[model samples]
Target: MTSVVPVLNDSMVAGYLERFITEELHSSGFTEASIAVSGGLDSAVVLKLACDALGTAHVHPVFLPYKASSEESRRDAGAIVSACGLAWTELDITAMADAYVALEPGIDRLRTGNLLARLRMAVIFDQSKKEHSLVIGTSNKSELLVGYSTWYGDMACAMMPIGDLYKTQVRSLAAFMGVPQQIIEKPPSADLWTGQTDEAEIGVTYDTLDQVLFLLVDQRLSPEEVAQQGFEAGVVRAVERKIVSSQFKRVLPPIAKTSQRTVATDFLYPRDWCT
Candidate 1:
């Protein structure tokens, strides 16, 4: 059978997202956008969209790299920034990260990676403040659904233009937008450590993961039903588990109700609400 995931019309998606970036920023009373570019496909797509929507002068792209970050990352990041006609800006987080890493001698790669991500998050927000821009997140649907990202770390952002698009779809849009072939083709990684790829950590390739996600989430198929679609039951269940577990990353923190109206529950106001 053909792939269960739908192929996107790149041109249409591009136009819609460009408008999305523009309207989202304008609605929030902001005219500038700040992005954390990882030299990866998602960020490349977001950066390009922001530039198209608001112009190069209005979009500020910054590269935040840890000491162990790949040289390839730096090179690809530079290429995309130059392609967008924006001046290259990067900040090294090694010193900031290592300062805390030294406190805990036995901290493993997982903790260290989270530290780096949060550090990058802190820096990006500061940079956004310095430039008076809103932070545009680069996470795709696959990572967000599977809980593959660090919460309040890489996930913290003013808005996510590609948050709804899956990894496979993002790749298609990236190609259409003429993002560098090397960045699009590179194995997806957070670059937390040497030779680490997202697939290796997630235990599934995006091609398969995205298909399973479409069936289970978008199609709303039961685990058994998805398994019947020629997918291994084990993989189906694993994806379901991820979606269930990572759900916290998708929404606001829960509040224990003591009063009649509680923040984030009943006292919520629209994001664009004017006082």
Candidate 2:
């Protein structure tokens, strides 16, 4: 059967995203970008795009690794940095994360993972401040839709160049942009813990998940209709549930409207709004 997700014109997509990064940064009165490169496919692609958009010197890539993060992650992250013609910037979050982890005894993997992600977020923002650059996010549409990302952690960013692309599409784009093959072919992982992979946590491969997401979200098909298209009913419903449950991650938090105008409500303004 034909794939539900349309194959992207990688050259066009790359050119468009490069333009997007340049325009978004300039609009905000910034000329540089910082990204947290986790030795994963998404970050690798985003890093490449940023370097291409803003020049190697203008884009800073930092690898933030926890104690349990795999060595492969570190190596792959370094490879991408070299490929983009940038110097290596590494910050180990183990000490900081463990200091907090010690306070809460018996913290499960889930909570510890979140702590690590948020710590990385904090460090990356600080690094961006030091570099006077915006933090470019690496989240793709698949993670954003299914709520697979850490809230306020990996999701925190000034701009997301590849936010609209699905995970499968990201791989394709990565390949087209000459991202390291090992990074592109490896199983997707948050690297929160040793031997953990994204597909294992999401309970489905990206190939399956992206198709379901395209049918439900892009095609505007109901769950029932998606299942009719040869997708498993359970998988379709699970994907739908994730999209619904993770809606909060996709938007700004709501504020009570006691007055006529409130932040993110009636007082909405563009990021580049000037008085």
State the lDDT of candidate 1 residue by residue for 82-129, as single tens digits.
899998678999998999989999999999999999999999999999
Worst 10 residues of 2 by lDDT: 265-274
Error of 2 at 8 (Å): 0.8
* Model 1: per-residue Cα lDDT at residue 130: 96
| Model 1 residue 195 lDDT score | 100
**Each candidate's lDDT (Cα)?**
0.93, 0.93
Q: Per-residue alpha-carbon lDDT of model 2 for 232-259, expressed as tens digits? A: 9999999999999999999888788899
